[model samples]
Target: MSMKLITAIIKPFKLEDVREALAESGITGLTVTEVKGFGRQKGHTELYRGAEYVVDFLPKVKIEVVVAEDAVETSLEAIAKAARTGKIGDGKIFVTSVEQVIRIRTGESGESAV
Candidate 1:
């Protein structure tokens, strides 16, 4: 079966809930990273223009999970449910196809690599 990579950019605080949801959905492995960027909302500022605009870097967390195609929907739903705090900066999710996977230490392939 083919694989899918699900990447989610979420608020930092909701990470724990997302992790638990993933685990509950039978997703055992995922990679998380702290990232800084802006979206359609653009950047924000504070104070007078001359007095250090104080642009909020906007803290975010990135979660990456690879799963079989059949499991993709479940994983996506889990992430959505867990990451949804109904806040302005909750971030977004992206899903893409993966051709193959290989385990670094054991040389395993396919879903085992996940």
Candidate 2:
């Protein structure tokens, strides 16, 4: 079976929802990172202690998952539904082909490694 890598960038507050959704979709494992970036929404201004500052990057959560090709659609739907807030900064999801996977300790490769 072919494998795929799914990457999603979403609002930090939506991480938990996305995780739960993925798990329910039969995706058991994923990697998450705290990230900062800007797109169409750009950044915003913050007023602190009488001084105003421009925030160029916004906090976001990056989620990465590897799954069999057959599971890709469900995974994408799960993430999109869970992360959507009907507003700007809801973020984006990307899917890419995976050439191979290897389990370091077990020496298992391909779909099994995933």
Candidate 3:
């Protein structure tokens, strides 16, 4: 069976929206990581102790989901639509090949494992 991996780095605040969207798409499994990074959106400047500072590596949430090939586009669209904020720091989505998946408990692999 064909399988795929999708990784989305989104603004921290959008995590809930993305999660709900994914669930609505019949996606029930995923991995999430608290992360920090920058792109064209770059970092921001903040005031602390009456001082100005350039805060690097904006806080972000990395969401990783694996699914059967046919579900890829739907999942991508759901995540993108949910995460969009009409702002520069919306973040990015990446899709890549996943050669294998394994569910240790049931000894399931391939699409079923995902």
Q: Number of clashing pairs, model 3?
A: 0
Query: Each model's C-alpha lDDT?
Result: 0.90, 0.97, 0.94
| Number of colliding residue pairs in model 1 | 0
- Evaluated at residue 57, the lDDT of candidate 2 is 98
lDDT of 2: 0.97
Roughly what TM-score does model 1 have, to 2 decimal places? 0.89
| lDDT for each residue of candidate 2 in 12-85, tens digit (9 for 90 to 100) | 99999999999999999899999999999899999999999999999999999999999999999999999999
How do all models score by TM-score? 0.89, 0.98, 0.96
In terms of lDDT, the best-performing candidate is 2
- RMSD for each model, in Å, please? 2.3, 0.6, 0.8
Q: Over the stretch 1-114, how does candidate 1's per-residue lDDT look in tens digits? A: 999999999989999999999999999999999998768646577779568575657778999999999999999899999999776777899999999999999999998888
* Stretches of model 3 off by over 4 angstroms after superposition: none
Query: CA shift at 39, candidate 2, in angstroms?
Result: 0.8
Better of 2 and 3 by lDDT: 2
